[model samples]
Target: MMDSPDSLVYLDGVSKLYATPQGLLPAVRQVTLDVRAGEFYSLLGSSGSGKTTTLRLIGGFEIPDSGRVMLGGEDVTQLPPHRRNLHTVFQNYALFPHLNVAQNIAYPLKIAQLPSAEIKLRVEAALEMFRITGLGERRPAQLSGGQQQRVALARALIGRPKVLLLDEPLSALDAKIREEVRQELRELQRQTNLTFIYVTHDQEEALALSDRVAVMQQGRVEQVGSPREIYDCPASLFVAQFIGKANFLTGRVLQTDPLTVMVQNLPIRASAMGYQPQLDETVTLMIRPEQLQIAESQPDAAPTAVQAATQAAAQLSVNQLSGRVIGDTYVGQLLQVQIETALGRLTATVLGKASLSSEVNLTWLVSACTVIPPALATMPSP
Candidate 1:
């Protein structure tokens, strides 16, 4: 694929391998990505997914076995880290123990051989920009995790690099501080208008902080899109299960137009999105827990078996299912309820409360659920 004209960083068919005791193992395999200028793009995946390796390749710290890494339309795949127009803020903050915060932020400028007076002025401005002006004299050991993170970011941006690469910079901070820093990071990126390529294994962090995210697995990208696209319309089962909580139900395709599938002797209507599944082909249906609506069932109005079957058939036109509550847990403002239905056990995140072992009706629109083909099924055209 051609790189976008506005892309500040472009990875073209990049691949990396490591020589271990077990022999050569691929860490990044034929990955291609384009990060638009001034956009917050993230590489998101668990450990061993090669996200950090990919970031290192971009930073020119790790040489790829094949392909090129381009920054601002110039190939820098073989260049040294200092030669690239980018700086990396590592997970541990990597602050020098002996240097105070001002000196740490000024180190990059010092290395550039700027005038002493200019360096002092820039360091003061950076400290004020990062809200650490009063703590400039404190060493890394004397500061909090969040303060250290600010020092690291200040040091990185002090160089005014074209792109800033972060490798889980907030992972060491406590939850509250992490959130605060995450928001500050986003705001800083917008305020500076600098492109940011962040690497993280935390799905929530990626979804909340990034303008777009690339989901990586086994050294390959599964999907790349906006957070809402990744969460609401995942491209594969892996992505569906990885980004958030999803409930899956397997069924065989009964029809193609306005796609219908049969699950547990009940016909389920689902949206095909862009996928085309053939009749008789088994497919999995996925729905988010929050998409389902649950209500208490009227036990006094319970219908006979035949009437219930008729009602089920009629309800198939929409999406409705009857289930008995098996579990209920309070999570913040929402209630996580698990129910046992004919198809299988499903979890629903709803407001209010639900009693355990009580019959309830679950309803959702056909568009609320997506049809995912089997592993061997052909993927939709790009």
Candidate 2:
């Protein structure tokens, strides 16, 4: 598949193989992806899910076994790393210990044989661009992790590559500093208008940093969409589970219109989006924990709670379940309450201040749920 004219980087049916002691292993399967010019795109997955390998393929560090890699609409699959106009920043800030900050940033320019005066001007500009103006004389060992990362970025951007490939570069920083650097990286990308193809195993980092994300599993791209689209309307079970915490219920299709399914023989109202479901087909239902609402009600208290549950269930636009509050875990501002429903165990998130204990009725709007067909219900292991 050829990349669109707007794409700065394109990978078409790319695959990479490695020989391990276990035998020949496939690090990356037939994957096709595109990153628009000046866009921030991310390849996200778990360790060994082929995200880093995909980034390496884009940067020309590794060639694909059977597919083409195009940079700016030109084939670069057989090109050497130095021949590509893309630069990569590895997880470990690869800085020379012997060189000072300015020298390290100017190395690429020096290698290009630019004038000494030009090198000095660009090096100083790079330092100020990364907010490390006065640290030019300091060695990499003398700088903090964040500072070292800045120097690495300055060095990579000093040459003004067409695209930047980042391989889990911020994984080494502390949580606080990692977040701060995330903002800085985004700002820098905007200021430079450089296409960034970032790879990471951190789910939150991908969601927070990328304009679009390609979720990979077992060397294959499970889904590609904007962060919100990926999170709210996952294309497969792997994406639903990988992108966020999802509560799943095994069910069978009850009706295609107004979307209804039967979970443990109980009719569950759901939103099926544009999917056409055959009646009585077995399927899975997914809903976010925060979408569920809980209210304290005794199952045996004067039949009031039972009446309410029944009424809620009768409504075709809502799914209702009564359960016992088995336990609750406090996560920041939300309390994740686990409930033992009649069908099985389920979890719901409510405000931390909610009085959650004993019998409770769980209700969630149909619009907040997603129905997954049986084909996309299972995730292949990497």
Candidate 3:
């Protein structure tokens, strides 16, 4: 993968094994990842998914049991933490209670033995960058949680580390403050041109902030792709269910084509990205809530594409599903509608502003459906 134009960090088949009481627990299993230069990469997963372990390996905090971690074309798998050009922002905001903000930000520079004037200059710059200049005189306890978090950030960035490791840095903050800090982190990274490895379990945050996201499950990575790619083109049922909210239909494949697949007694034609699965094979048809459309059908669309409308009973044909709106709930800017179709219960998210009827009946373009082969490795395309 480094044969690409801009590969900056490489993890080659890295694995970590722990001797548990029951048996060996593999925290990370043969995961290979390539981070391009200046990319805001997020290792997204639940706790114990190896996201933190990956970050520590990259930062030289822990050595991998197998494989190598490379940075800037050099192998640093065995390098000590002090020898690595990296900085870490812990979730706990590991600030020194005895020290003020200025002192805390200056700690790293002091350890590096920089001149007093230079340390002061760097601390001032970091405080100014985080917009916490005035709070620098206050101890961590004297500041708000947000301010204290920024102090931790300033401390990490003060040393001008080539790579920044953020271990759920915003997880400790409340929702309102978390949003603010996440934005600050992105802006700080862009302005400083720093490569960041962010670990987070929040799907929205990962999608909003990362240029690329690595979705890990159990001990191995399930998919490595852009947020859009992973969100829309989930490679596995686990991914489809994990990354965000998704509705899947399980059925037996009867026919197939590059543009469509006949599964679960439904003919699903996706937007030019379908694959041919063997007949009689169990397959899952996956579709996001937002991808589906409701109400009257449009001109120049397929007759078999839209699901059968409950109101227009006689007009139904082709891929039309026979389902009823089981429930509809308002979710801020969207309406999540659950329907009982022939395939099973499926959810569709309509725009908040969209005009909805009490008894919802809908039709979707064939291009919106994704046919996922059951137990298959590759996921259904968007």
- For each candidate in turn, the TM-score is 0.93, 0.92, 0.87
Mind giving the per-residue lDDT tens digits that candidate 3 earns over 1-382?
A: 3434466778988988878998988888888888887889999999999888888889888899998898888899999999888899887888998998899999999999999999888888888878897887898989888888888888898888878889998888889878887887888778888899999999899999999999988767888899998887776787788888887766665545434456555665443243456766666667788876655334555456334354355322214554566678899888988876776777888875333333444566555566653454553321
* Candidates by lDDT, descending order: 1, 2, 3
lDDT of 2 by residue, 58-114 (tens): 888888888999998899999999999988888897999999999999998998899
- Number of clashes found in candidate 3: 6
Residue 263, candidate 1: Cα error in Å is 1.6
Clashes of each: 0, 0, 6
Q: Which regions of candidate 1 fall more than 4 Å away from where they truly are?
A: 302-317, 373-382
True-vs-predicted CA distance for residue 264, candidate 3, Å: 3.8
Model 2, position 365, has a per-residue lDDT of 87
Residue 118 displacement (Å), model 2: 1.6
The true-versus-predicted C-alpha distance at residue 361 of model 3, in Å, is 3.5
Candidate 1 per-residue lDDT, tens place, 1-382, comes to 7878988999998999999999999999889999999999999999999999999999998999998999999999999998998999999989999999999999999999999999999999999988898998998999988889999999999999999999999999999788888989999999999999999999999999999999999788888999998888888898889998999999899988878989869988888883678999888889999999899899788689999898777665559889999998899999999999998999999999999999999988788788764563453221
Give the Å error, residue 332, model 3.
1.6
Model 2 TM-score (2 dp): 0.92
Itemize residue pairs with steric clashes in candidate 1. Answer: none
**Number of clashes in model 1?**
0
Candidate 1 vs candidate 3: the lDDT winner is 1
In candidate 3, the residue pairs with backbone N, CA or C atoms under 3 Å apart (3 or more residues apart, or in different chains) clash, namely 304-318, 304-319, 307-320, 307-321, 308-320, 308-321
Indicate whether candidate 2 or candidate 3 has the larger TM-score: 2
